[model samples]
Target: MAANNGLRYKDKVTIVTGGSKGIGLGVVQVFVKNGAKVVFCARREAEGKEVEADLNKLGIGEALFIPCDVSKEEEIKNLIEKTVAKYGRIDCLVNNAGYHPPHMPIDDFSSDDFRELLNVNLVSYFIAAKYALPYLRKVEGNIINMSSLVGQIGQFGAVTYVATKGGISAMTRALSIDEAKYNVRVNSVSPGNVWTPMWNSGAQATPNPEKTIENGANSQLIGRYGTLEESGTACLFLAADATFCTGIDLNLSGGAELNYGIKTMRGEKELPF
Candidate 1:
């Protein structure tokens, strides 16, 4: 069969949380384009519907958009049940549903804000995996958690977000160990500076949005922001091709996480990519 002739993930079922937009949407597109039947969820019903409409046009695979708030247990359960009911089996689970709240000073964070951050950013990933595990076990499928570079290397002024991301990376390793007996692989994708809606939002919040954007691009060694499609491709590789890989955290950043000595650093900065 041709690569596009339903070869890669042909008829395989996958679930992508937060698939309406950003990296999650990119993942959904990659899987669907490769012939995987996908079920994705978003908190915004309107945005979810829009994605559903676009994905449905892909004749090779089917995409279902279920409005879901992954932060809530009941909603998470519903998302999984609905997927299983429609597709009968789940071959992959991409825990891409997440949120990054504004940068909050450590001393200024309220109790509710702290809890909300963890609940959305970290807890949702665990809950979705918990509900998806039984089906994943049957197929010996894999799990891909969407983590961030900030998780591995702490970010200033975003203590809670950083903590949640770090937790995700650690969880990926630990879960890989636990699921080994069942032949299930667990891993994570830690993205660097992907220019997605999240990044744009952060830029919009800054005093000089354009300048902040430029600075962000220049921070990456690649001199440009990584694309959503790139991040999506990484997730697809982890789910479909990395059969012997587990407990590993793949960095999707363009060498942004690497540490270089001051002497080796760029003598002068160039235009951002």
Candidate 2:
């Protein structure tokens, strides 16, 4: 197939969680730009409303913002119900809402803390998928779960977060198999060091924020953080273009995991050739 044009998803309906900011915002923007009717949610009503207003100004597509806290089952149920009531059908679900706390050692976290994080990060995805499946099945739609590269590899002092992401990827694969009979595709995107508000806050919390961000950029072979637009574009590809792909965790790592060695700074040395 040729690439998706600007209006490829014209009139398609998509639901994105955590769409008020960061990667979720990017996803909402891309879908709207491609002419998808996007219903996005976040816990903060103010931010959600602002994003809705801004996206609506583009005039290419429509955007609806609903205040939702994914950790609550009732809220998630209501979110799905409201989307269906308004749009009459759903074509895609992007389970992207997540919570990541500051890095903490395993000993510092209690079992409850781990479970609580799971509720926000992993379990919500399951709930969203469960509720969205009927509508998705009817339209042969797809689900895209936001995972992280640390889920595949390991990250020190972030055991709880890693566990949830790993669970998401595994659940995505399993759900894909079961949903195949219904023609509902399930997949995930595992991103590494995407430059979002969360990344900025984390960097700012460090003693030397500038150096922290620089190190993060240098960690990737591409020598920079992934942009919000890039993240959005990746999700767009999986949703609209990768028709044959399912149950796979697409890595958006910028080659961060390609090898194990010191990274060379760009323009710092001549090539061996």
Number of the top lDDT candidate: 2
**Cα lDDT of all candidates, in order?**
0.87, 0.91
Off by over 4 Å in 1: 1-6, 261-273
Global fold similarity of model 2 (TM-score):
0.93
Q: What TM-score goes with each of the models? A: 0.93, 0.93
lDDT of 1: 0.87
Residues 1-273, model 2: lDDT tens digits: 535455878888999999999999999999999999999999999999999999999988899999999999999999999999999999999999997877767889999999999999999999999999999999999999999999998775689999999999999999999999988899999998999999999888777789888988977899999988898899999998899999999999998887886544467442111
Candidate 1 lDDT by residue in tens digits, 1-273: 576564578778999999988999999888888888999999899998888788888677888999999889999999999999988998999998887776656887887887998999899999999999999999999999999999987775688889899999999999999999999999999988888898899888876789989977876788899887888889888888899999999998878877662433245352122
State each candidate's clash count.
1, 0
Clashing pairs in 1: 223-273
